[model samples]
Target: MAQDPPAQDLMHYESMAQDALRGVVKAALKKAAAPEGLPGAHHFYITFKTEAPGVSGPDDLLSKYPDEMTIVLQHRYWDLAPGETFFSVTLHFGGQPKRLSVPYSAVTRFYDPSVQFLLQFEAPAGEAAASAAEAAAPSPPPAAPSAGEGEAKIVSLDQFRKK
Candidate 1:
């Protein structure tokens, strides 16, 4: 006989872990917020939900990227401040500077292309629950390459060689 899994998660471990990961993002932002500003070729690409609560941005930017927006904190950005619940920064859009405030909960992805480090979070609760069915739909496995379609080879030359 096998034991059954618990139907309810009393400890809420997943949410706790998620919060912990968000904390890492916060810590990294705090480092970037310092005067040195993104040490030695290090930069970040942060993606967030535009409609999430506590997200503040210019009207044009919000309208332009209504669903999601990705911002690069590289050489041109200014005033990268990480706060208790949110981080605010000034970034240039189309030669104009705009300040944006996004709560950590709204952020879904954090990446540093220089070091190739990345952290991705699940979508906000409302969006996730709304699209649960679509997300749950299973897709068929990808088809294998026929011949020399990719870097890896399936057949060996020795298999056809005379003995």
Candidate 2:
């Protein structure tokens, strides 16, 4: 006799877990936004989608980084503001100041090289629906590595899939 297929996930536990982790990013940014500024050597490298909803930045910047971009929050960044759903900040690009607004949902990775802490998030559902041509386009290169940076360690979720 043939066996039945395994049950599907109706609760979407993966999505829920991702949302909770994004909250962690939000909390960290909130802390950095305090008047005292980031305490100690704690800094952030935030990577996010440029096309994601609620994301806004300079037109030239969006063109240069059509897919995604990473920003460093170590020093010289200003106007750090974290809202309920999105965060905005000002950073200099080639000596020109530019403001960026990125929603929490757009963030894909958050790393603090100072403490070697990292968090990665799966792409949003909309990103997965892009056409083949779009997917084939080359992604922008990541920002330069900081001192003491190590090789990237990716965390896969295939083990959690139901057989």
Candidate 3:
């Protein structure tokens, strides 16, 4: 019998690091969800995959994304309840308050301009539930005032790739 060759493995610490950073975003959202609303001009730009699991909102919105979508956290948002696994909120768009639920695991990117801190996450392997949830929810336009205008740095993993 031939002996097996020495196995070389890639270090996945990057994924672990990404998970830790996402925890930071979760913590911030939890804090903001508290009584005080987005203290000191602090806001968020959360981008996630529409197809990920545990996401709920609208079908049209998901259709528009077809893959991913970005949402903002600032004025005119209500009922922000952040839990260990997920967060729920209601935002007013076109003079109507639409509710949305997103699991932290579904989040692909998180950014806070006030602190210039950003985090990017990898899409999970399977996320059919997210799409189903969004489809079940009422349809709403993908219009967010803050998302319209901002100086945001896109966090792309390509930067970390080696030639």
Top-scoring candidate (TM-score) = 2
Sort all candidates by TM-score, best to worst. 2, 1, 3
Q: If both were scored by lDDT, which would come out higher, candidate 1 or candidate 2?
A: 2
TM-score of 2: 0.79
lDDT of 3: 0.70
lDDT of 3 by residue, 1-163 (tens): 9999976657777667877877897889988888987889898878887667788986654565666767678776789998888888876544456677888888977877777776767676565566567669957545433432322222333333346
lDDT of 2 by residue, 1-163 (tens): 9999988999999999999999999999999999988999998888888889899989987776677777878767789999999999988776567899999999988888788788988776778657345658865444443323322222222232246
Lowest summed lDDT window (length 10), candidate 3: 148-157
Clashing pairs in 1: none
Local distance difference test scores for all models: 0.75, 0.78, 0.70
Candidate 2 lDDT score relative to the true structure? 0.78
Estimate the overall C-alpha local distance difference test score of candidate 1: 0.75
Question: Model 3, which residues run further than 4 Å from truth?
Answer: 1-12, 126-163
C-alpha displacement of 150 in model 1, angstroms? Answer: 38
RMSD of each: 12.3, 7.0, 8.3
Q: What lDDT score goes with residue 114 in model 1?
A: 83
Candidate 1 vs candidate 3, lDDT winner: 1
Compute each candidate's TM-score over C-alphas. Answer: 0.78, 0.79, 0.68
